[model samples]
Target: MLAVALAAQFMALLDAFIVNVAAPTIQSELHASGAGLQLVIAGYTITYAVLLITGARLGDRLGHRRVYLFGLAVFTVASLACGLARGTGELIAFRLLQGAGSAVLIPQVLSLIQRNFAGEARVKALGAYSAVLATGAAAGQVLGGVLVSADLLGTGWRPVFLVNVPVGVVLLALAFRVLPRDDAAALAAGRARGLDLPGLVLLGAAVSLFTVPLVLGQQEGWPLWSWLSLAAAVLFFTLFCAYESRLARRGGAPLIAPRLLRSPGMGLAVFRVAAVMAVNAGFLFVVTLHVQGGLGYSALRAGLTFAPSAVVFGAVGLTWRRWPQPLQRALIPGGFALAAVATAAVGLLLRDGGDGGLWLYAALVGVGAGLSLGFGPTLTRALATVRAEDAADASGLLATVTQLGQLTGVACFGALFLHRLESAGAPGAYSSSDALLVCAYALASVAALGAVSGLVRLRR
Candidate 1:
């Protein structure tokens, strides 16, 4: 059951990053314009983030297992369509479909774990889940490089999407055999709330407005439309909150629980997750650009730079349970601090645009291990207080926020890095390495804030 769920999840997450290394190839082959290429990439994430809560509610309203299979089937078909697409428009449309399928399937993984596991076993499962989440992102880069470079069947970038076809087929089979249907008790709990369409629409609009701008603003050079969209996002979100509050007053279950954030440690823990995830995303973006675009590293070598972090993160995630209880608790904040130091070291060591050597590799390794310590425990604790009935809500909320955090980090830090480069011009102006140095320092600062937030949450 676990293998089936994780494999399905890894496939979806892999698609999120797998195109990065192949973007150039895709653009060339499809005769895609620059804006068209950006759309091909951002459309998936935009829809994925926007529709996540609705998807979570669907799992609750229907059934997790039912939703999982349906989503897998949709995702599988979409992957095939994406690979077969003959034009950039077709590819972009299919990519959006792929994201929607992922949104539908992913919430079930967490809901299943929370429902089925207990005690230390639950902790271990959560750790493994976290490992899959982190590792999937790193692996996509490496695998994308390999698939594009190999040009399997001379198909070039198509294999990245095509690869999901067989895996999804297998997962669909396993899901039927292993995934449990909703029990009477779970069904009763889930049915307590309707789909809440008005709330769903409001929240979806808010997220779409917020994320679309972030995804496109940097490329568009932060045009007036982006700022206006952001302002409208705030308006829509305010309306969403007010509507949700009204729904609660009317004895309706809100799309998001009105009181969920008020639960002890919940808000702070979510913030910590958001902060760390943002920094992690920004780190990946800045470093990728620095290595490949600035430092002139080959795609394969640049991808390999992230391998140490993925390995360490997986190792620490799987093994964290062996530590003493108190030590495990201490590690959350300690891990954040460690991540901050390592991130700062990376900034300093690579400031000159040279490979940071083995020390840089060690620092990258620390990045994953430290983040694992903080993220896995924080996730466990955040959901610890949630009711089983609200598991889908919590999972969807966290997943959506994590995705939003990545979007925000990439937009904000990516822009900052570019701005730095623009300021340091050819009249002895800044290089891409200088921009990277600045972004790395900023990422370290965010890591430090995550540590502080972790410690503060512990006291509560």
Candidate 2:
């Protein structure tokens, strides 16, 4: 059962990142526009974020097993569709479907783990889960590179999507046999939602309004609509907060309960997580592009470059809890500072189309080692202070926030990188290096902010 759950998770997280290594190939083959490529990436993340809470609610009311199977079916079929897609529009649409399926199913893994495992067994299950997830995310880049470079049957980048079909099918069979049956009460509740639908819509609207412009503004020459859209994003977000607050006051289970945000240190902790995730996703996107798109590195080589970062990150994340209490506490701030330095070093090393040498690999390792502390530990630290019951809600909210942060990073930094290429007159090996260099520095600044935020939280 644990293996089945982790396999599903591995597939889901793999798709989240596998596209990075294949992006240049996809663009060149499909004749995809800059905005189109951004959509290809951000669309998945946006839909996943918007529907995650609702997905969790569905499992509570409808049965985890039932919803999990349904979601797997949707995801499997969508993966096939994505592989068969002939154009940018088709691929982007399929990607959204894939993300929806993922959202519906992913929350159930944790629910199932909690339901099925207990005591020491549960602890071990969760550890394995975390390790597999960390491995999956890093492995995606390497795997995608291999598949694309292999050009099996001359299919180019399509293999990345198609690879999921068989795995999903096998998982579906195993899950049906091994997944525990849901309680009678869960089924009786049916499709009913305790969801905050209005809040969901408002949040979705705000993100879409904001992200659409970022991805497309340069492609469309920055029309008046872009500015109007960004303005609308701010307004919608304000309305969302007000609505959540009102619901909380009335004792409703508001999406992202306002009281949670109001808790001491909670908001800052959330911001620190968001900043780290934004930098993480943004760094991967731009650097992959810089290497493969601009510097003519093969997809395999490009993906392999991230090996150090991935290995160090997973190792650190798994073992961080073993450190002494004081050292663990200090690690968060220190991790952020290390990440900031490493990120800036990357920028400096790669500024003129030169791949940062062995030192560059060292910087990448530093990035992975540092950000790993800022993520899982930050969550554990924040939750240590929260009441037990609210832990689930806080976890769901943080999950959604991380997805939003990823989408935001890809849309904004990707747009800037694309625009830089356009203004410089056609991308070349060295011409677009500065674009990535600039974005790297910006990410470093965000890392520095996380460091400062962690320090302030420590003082408080």
Candidate 3:
């Protein structure tokens, strides 16, 4: 059961960044502009982030097993559609569908683990889950490069999507055979509670309004419409919050329970996760562009460049349990600090027109170590104060925040990278150096903020 759950998660997370290494290829082959490529990446993340909470609610209301199967089927079909897409527009549309399917699939993995495992067993299951997430992300980069370079049957980047079909089919079959049936009583209770349709709509609208402008603004040369969209995002988000609070006060089940947000550490957790993930997502997206797009490295070489970081990330994650509590708590700020230094070093290396050498690899290792160490620990701390009954809600909200962070990172950094390229007048090793430097400094500032927050919370 753990193996099956991890496999499903692996696939979902893999799709998140697998396209990074392939972005250049897709653009060249499909004649996709920078904005089109950004959509190809951001569209999936946006949909996935927006729908995650709703998907988790559906799992609770329907049944984990049932919802998981449905999501898997949708994901499988979407993968096929993505592979078959003949143009950038078609690919972006299919990727959105794929992201929706993933939102459904991911929450169930955690639900199943909580339902099926107990005590130490549950702890181990969660650890394994985290490992899969880290590994899958790294593997996506490597696997994407291999598929694109292989061009199996002269298919180029199509195989990256096509490959999921068989794996999803096998996982679906295994799930049916191995996963336990739904709890009839829980299903009944969930059915009795109505879905918060209004909350869902408002939340989705707010997220789309905020993210769409980030993606489209620079591409359209920052027209008046983009500023209007940004303003609309604020309005929609304010309205969504007011509506959710009203619903919760009325004893209704809000899309995000107000109580969850009120918990100690919850607000800080959300901020930290958003900041860290933004840097993580932005770093990967920009580095891929710099190495493959600017430096003219092959897909395989670019993918392999990430190997050191990935390995270090996995190692740090696996051994994290052995660290002291203070060390564990400090990991968030410490990790971010290391990542900031690494990013700065990489920017310098690129600006100097030097090939990223041993130092570059070391810096990547720092990034992986910091992010991996910080991620799970921060999540655990964030949910520590929530009641048992609200655990599911807390988990869902946290996951949603994580995805939003990724979306922000991708959209913002992608736009910045493209704009830099245009102003620099050509793609070269140092053309995007200023963008990278800005991101690195921003990360450093965020790390300091995390440290201050941690200290303040302790003093309180």
The segments of candidate 1 whose C-alpha lies over 4 angstroms from its true place after superposition are 427-430, 457-460
| Per-residue accuracy of model 2 over 53-74 as CA lDDT, tens digit each | 6676677667888888988899
The deviation in Å at residue 309 for candidate 3 is: 1.6
lDDT per prediction? 0.86, 0.78, 0.77
Q: Candidate 3: misplaced stretches above 4 Å?
A: 27-39, 86-89, 134-136, 384-388, 418-427, 458-460
Candidate 1's residue-wise lDDT over 288-334, tens digit each? 88888787777778778899988888898888878887797688888
Clashing pairs in model 3, backbone N/Cα/C closer than 3 A? none
Using lDDT as the measure, the top candidate is 1
Q: Evaluate residue 195 in candidate 3 and report its C-alpha lDDT on the 0 to 100 scale.
A: 80
Cα-lDDT of candidate 2:
0.78
What are the candidates' C-alpha RMSDs? Answer: 1.6, 3.4, 2.6
After TM-score superposition, what is the CA distance of residue 81 in candidate 2 from its true location, in Å?
2.1
lDDT: worst 10-residue window of model 2: 386-395
Best by TM-score: 1
Q: Which TM-score value belongs to model 3?
A: 0.91
Tell me the number of clashing residue pairs for each predicted model: 4, 0, 0
